[model samples]
Target chain A: MKKKFQNSKTETVVYFICSLVGLLIVWQLAVSFTSLQKVMPSPFVVLGFIGQSLTQKIGGKILPLHILASLKRVFVGYFLACIIGIPLGILMGCSKTGKAIVKPIFELLRPIPGLAWIPLAILWFGIGETSKYFIICVSAIVSIILNAYAGASQVDQTLVGAARMLGAKPAQIFLYITLPASVPQIFAGLQVGLSSSWMAVIAAEMIRANEGAGWIITTGMESGNTVQILAGMISIGLVGLLLASLLRLIERGLCSWNIQGR
Target chain B: MSKVEVNHLTKSFGSLKVLDDISFQVNDGDFLCIVGPTGCGKTTFLNSLVKLYDIDDGEILINGEEVDLNKHSIAYIMQEYSTMSWLTVKENIQFGMKVRKFSKEKLNRKTEEVLKMVGLEKFADYYPEQLSASMLQRVSIARAFAVEPDLLLMDEPYGQLDLELRFRLEDELIRIWQETKTTIVFITHNIEEAVYMSQRIMVLTNKPTKVKEDFVNPLPLPRNVTEEKFIEMRNKVTNLIKWW
Candidate 1:
């Protein structure tokens, strides 16, 4: 049974790789057959753009600068979200008082889309990295809050009872049972935050910033540099994919004991 | 001398009284099993003593001292399969010890002792997801034992298991009880399990429950439930809970 499960996972990884390769092949073929370069740049054109960006000197108008800029915003925004979200989520899950206190405002405000915050963020923090950081942070907080809330709320009450029975203080029970169980679900939230960071970067860069991936695309559109625009989009995809895979790898390392050689 | 005592446990849940004027004392080295119908507040009474829920009026004494609700030194092995899916079997076994802050040597000794006692030595490396339900329950039992608790409280610990595994686990429980001889208060919905396992079986009345009977199991160790007297006693207790 275990062997079959392992085989199926390997099969899944292979299937995923094959599908990605197939998409790239289709993209290359489409570009080759038609005058698609003006609208849809070829994968080779995009790769070449990436190669040029990568090999260019530091702080050039290329891939590495935008990549670094985007990374910075995502890290800051996500870090801020985690700082606020985790404690509030655990508190909400653990206490009726905390839930009652925060729930009304949370429900009322949660529906406002992260993009909608752009105007207000610009007004509050101005049209700079602050506004962008605000957008990214706003986009991330709600999902992390919701996921952490769920993870904490859904923790097995029996485990808490068992912990109490086994000489664990109330705080100890929360620390041991509530925190550990919430990690997988919290990571799920982080994954969402990661992908959404791409959108946030664009929103943040909609303001005047000469040093970002979002600015690259915005500038490309003005100059009619379709290759650069396409390259920026592709880079976002690659970076998002890379970050997601990294998160999964970290989760596996943290929870390796969970499934006995997962 | 008694290891634990429950005095006039009259507990009411707002309008309804779950445990009414109930009392019992558990001696050190005693294996006291409580059995009753589903709605007899058997669990409520147990939870009340442990202060899981507030009791309307009761005093629980342990080791001749008023049992401290805040000090969770007594180990409770729950009935349901509630092992931490994130933790491996060995980690779960080590959890209570970690909480108690035992010395490394002590933790190792206790963990080894309990895992071997429960016959879960070979599967120590397995996770809860990898183990069967019965095995998961054993890990819980192992965790409780690893703490070397002053009191072991179990609520229908083997209720989910099939007959063969239940009986085998019961044998394991008996061996551990014999070796450690700590005070125990076991709660079970099954009449036969109470008869087989307990030195004394305390039965409760319907919600607003009180002690209806506290039976002393005279049956020898390595109990034979198939025997005529065993069946007779089971039937008598079965009627006690089933009938008014």
Candidate 2:
């Protein structure tokens, strides 16, 4: 059993490496064999650009600094969404009046994507940090609210009844039963919300930013530097993977009892 | 005394009356099992006692006062396992005591005691999903017992368990009752189980439900299901509400 487990772990790393090597091989072959090489850089060129960007400036800052700048916007906006959306969603879910008052307004805004709000966000907040933050918040808050509302509203009635029978008061029931029961779902919301925040940051940065991965891509386009754009894309993908893994680790710690967490 | 009194209890869902003026009383520490035909509103009767449903006419009193869930210390085990899925076996057992604001020392003691009683000490950290059906039912029972309730209501708590596990849990339940002397009102469709577990058996008729028989169980403790006297009592109760 131990051997089998160890084998699967090693197999996962091996498979990941094989897929990346396969993709690189195909890219290199395409560059060598096709005229499309004029439009796109070879795999080696992009890799070299990424390595160079680690130490040298791309637009005005190094690649890591650019990635950090984008991450900061996501943190601020996503944190705001969590604080505001979670409580609002729970209130809407738990109270009939709250649902009636807030649900219609939320539904109206929900269908409009966060990227779609870029123009209005710029108009409202004047292309500043506030507008960018607003876009990320708008993108992320919907999923947060939806998941929190689902978690709170769909709590098992039997558990509530059991709590009441055990002499829990209204407030005690909410705190001990309702809140804990809703946690796994709240984490689910946060996961989606985090990804949304990340995406919104990229879109926001693309429009107007002096230092961010998105700025690297847009400026690369202006200067016709495919290597810079590919490097920026690669960094975004890596950072997104890291952020998601971190959230999953936090979820496992918070909701260890949850089946999904395990 | 932890007596439960139901007087003139009547409940209706729209036009269909499920329970009609049903009334009974259970004395302190009495193990009274309520048996009825399938779909004869047995669960609705239990729900009425818990005030989960509003009865059109009746009063359910615990020790001479109207049933106030918050004030009264009562533990109920429903047909479903009702073990909180998010909680471990230990936490599920402690759930009631924690809700009642038992002191930390008391909570720890009660949780340990009940976990041992249910034979789930080793599985204390195991989630409900990891447990078997019988184990889940045991967890529910342990949770109810941990509360040290004045009144315990169970609605076919072992309904999903197989016959052997059901018999085992029934015996375990009797042992707990004998030790604690907590007033228990158990509801079941199994006449044999009712005969095996109760000091008295109350039979209900088809809906609108009413008491068909309320009499003492003549069988002795540590009841042998195959014993002639036990079979006789079980058959008598079976005949009382046999829909088939």
Candidate 3:
């Protein structure tokens, strides 16, 4: 089993490198054969643009503006979701009344894409950062609530019975047995929610924004700069990848003793 | 004083009656084993005493007081592996003591004492999954003892072990019983084990189960299982349990 795991790790690393090389080859071919380079630009062209920008300052600003803007949007929306979703998920999982009340509302609203919420969000929170924040918040909250609920409810009933028989009270049982048991599941939900919100609501930002990576793309496209557009796209993908990796690390850290190996 | 008394006890599941008018007594410091065939309500009776299941009829008393079944402190070690999976052997053992609001110094001392008693002092850091089935059983036994419980209820505690490990655990149990002198009401399907462990054996009939036979074990302590008297007593109880 240990050898299998090591071999798989090596395979994945090699696969990632091969895929990057493959994409570069395709981009080079596209630049030579088609109009895609005129629109999307070649990978080398975009890398050259970013390299030039590394030394030259643009309007007394550097790369951090776009990076910081995107980071702030993610943190604000994600933090709000965490504060509201976790406890609510636990309650809904444990109580019939809570599930009965919350399930209907979630089902009705959950299917609507985050981008679709832009019109109402603009109306409600105005054409500001709040609208983008609302989009990400909506995108993440349902998964957190659902996963947390499932985790808390899925606790071993026998353990609850055993604890109660051992003289633990209702509150004590929840604190000692149920809550601790549900943690692995809760982490799973948070990972899913975090990654989804990171990737999904960035599209909402593209619809209308003065800042953010999504806005960076729109600005480059309007200015007819393919290299800048490609850089913006790459920025989005890189940030999403970094955030996803961070979440995976957190999941492993928090759920080290979880029953499932993953 | 009789630490436990079951009076005219009756319990049924739906239309099927599991126990019928069962009664027994265990004196303080006595090791009483209740043995019968499979599905003779041995577990149901034990569960009823702990009030894990609501009784259909009758009452159980602990030392002349009607056991406020909800309020009494009883340690129950089930046959199946149900120890908290995340907790280490030491933490599992200390659970009851923590629940009972024992002081940290007292909890530490009792944990150390019980870990030594189960010969699991070295395995205290192991999780339930890391330990063997017999070792897990020992942790369960240790948890039950850590509480310094007045009434200890065990349901086939050694039923999951290999023959050699089973005998070793039986001897371990006897050692703990002697040291703590806690009143134990053990339920098992093994008649030989019943004879080997108890001062009194209650043989239960098929459900709606009732006490079919009761025998006092007159054999001496540290009794040899290979002795002629031990074999004769085991055969007698085994015959009493046999049915078509």
Candidate 4:
């Protein structure tokens, strides 16, 4: 069984690499043969620019430093979202009064996109780090809260009853039963929120920032450097993939029980 | 060990009566099985006894006091495998003991005992999802028995298992009951299971469920289902529960 699982994993990685290579080849061919090259750089040019950016500075900072700056902004906003959203979601799920009081206001705000909050955030906090954080928080928080609420509310009542019968206090039930049971769902929320925060950081940086992946793109566009823009996009893609994989690894460690064929 | 007395038990769901004017008593160290037809409020009745469902009009007393979980040592095995999916078998078994703040020594001792008894000692580190259906049920059983509660409530715990697995589990339960001497109030729709396990069988009628019959089982322990007396007893309870 273990051998079968290992073989399956190896096959998946092989397929993934093949698909990526296939896409790059298709992109290279299109740029070489079609009028699409008029607007965009060839895949080779973009890839070379990305490799060069590793050693050479893109703006005042290296590519990694720009990514790090965006990461810092995303981290602050995403962290704030989690601490606030998880508890609030649990409150909404666990208490009728809490839900009744908060849900209407939440519902009213939920439909508004995080990008839409930019103007208001700028007005409220100015076009500074605070504004960027606010925008990213707003973007990421909705999914976090929604997923956490779903996790908390969906806890099996039968388990609660069983806990109570086993001499669990109300607080103990919440801690031991409600909290652990909701973890997988909370992780799901975190996954989505991280992506949202990453997207928001780029958008925020695009509007006003000296250093970031978004800044790299905006600067590249100003100079008509299509290769540089593609390089920035590729970096974003790689970083996004890395962040998602990192989160999945953490989730695997924490929620080993929820995984099948473990 | 605990004696349970339920009196004037009544429950309704938005004017639809489920259990009506029910009353019964379970003596200390007795294995009492309550059998009824499907949807006859057997679960509701058990839930109400455990105070999982609020009684419209009733009183449930454990050892002469109202059934308060905090004050009473009680364990309930739900129809669904209520094993904490996030926890391993050992952790699940220790959950109740941990909640009740059992001594480290007692906790370890009891956990080991129940794990061995349920034949889940090998799977102690395994999570609920990793286990088979019967193994999951055993985890639930081990978890319940680890607490060594004064009263144990089981709601059709083996209802989902195949007959062979069910029989094996039944024998394990009997052994556990004999060794522990805990007062058990088991609820099931299977009359033969009730006859096979219980020292006393209480038959409940259809909706607006009342106690149709409550009788002692004269059949000795390590009962033979193929025997005439066992068949006679199983048939008697089956006839009472037959709706069609």
- Candidate No. with top TM-score: 4
* Candidate 3 lDDT over residue span A1-262, tens digit each: 6798789889999999999899999989988799875656678878887676656643344555766687898888888888889998999889889989987887898788666777888899987788878888877888888889898899887677677767788788888888888887787788788876877556767757666776666777788877777777787777778887787777666655544523
Model 2, CA-based lDDT: 0.88
Residue A43 displacement in candidate 1 (angstroms): 4.2
Worst 10 residues of 4 chain A by lDDT: A253-262
Model 3 stretches with alpha carbons more than 4 Å out? A1-41, A46-63, A218-230, A259-262, B8-15, B64-70
Q: Order the candidate numbers by TM-score, best to worst.
A: 4, 2, 1, 3
Chain B TM, cand. 2 = 0.94
**Order of models, best DockQ first:** 4, 2, 1, 3
- Clashing residue pairs, candidate 4? none
Cα deviation in Å at residue A44, candidate 2? 2.4
lDDT of 4 by residue, A1-262 (tens): 7899899989989999999999999998888899998997878888888788888998899899998998889899999999999999988988889999988999999999999988888898888899999989999999999999999899999899889988999899999999989988998999999999988987898668999888998899899988888888888888988998898888888888887313
lDDT of 2 by residue, A80-139 (tens): 999999999999889999999999999999999999988888888997899888999999
TM-score, B chain, candidate 3? Answer: 0.93
Give the per-residue lDDT of model 2 (tens digit) for B1-244. Answer: 3899999999999999999998889999999999988888988988889888889998999999999998888999988767888789998888888777899999999888888876789999999988999899889888888888889999988888777767767888898889889899999887878888999999899998999989998777888989999988877987898866
Worst 10 residues of 3 chain A by lDDT: A55-64
- Model 4 residue A11 lDDT score: 100
Q: Which is superior by TM-score, 2 or 4?
A: 4
Per-residue lDDT over B89-154 for candidate 1, one digit per residue giving the tens place of the 0 to 100 score: 888999888888899999999888888877789988887888888788889988987887778888
DockQ score of each predicted structure, in the order shown? 0.58, 0.76, 0.39, 0.88
Tell me candidate 4's fraction of native contacts, as a decimal between 0 and 1: 0.94
Each prediction's Cα lDDT score?
0.81, 0.88, 0.81, 0.90
Model 3: per-residue lDDT, tens digit, B1-244?
2388888999999999999988877888888999888988999898888777889998888887876534677788887776887788998888878877899999999999989977899999877877898888888888887887777889998888778868877887777788878788889988778888898888899989999987788888887889999999988998999976
Q: After superposition, how far is residue A207 of candidate 4 from its true place, in Å?
A: 3.1
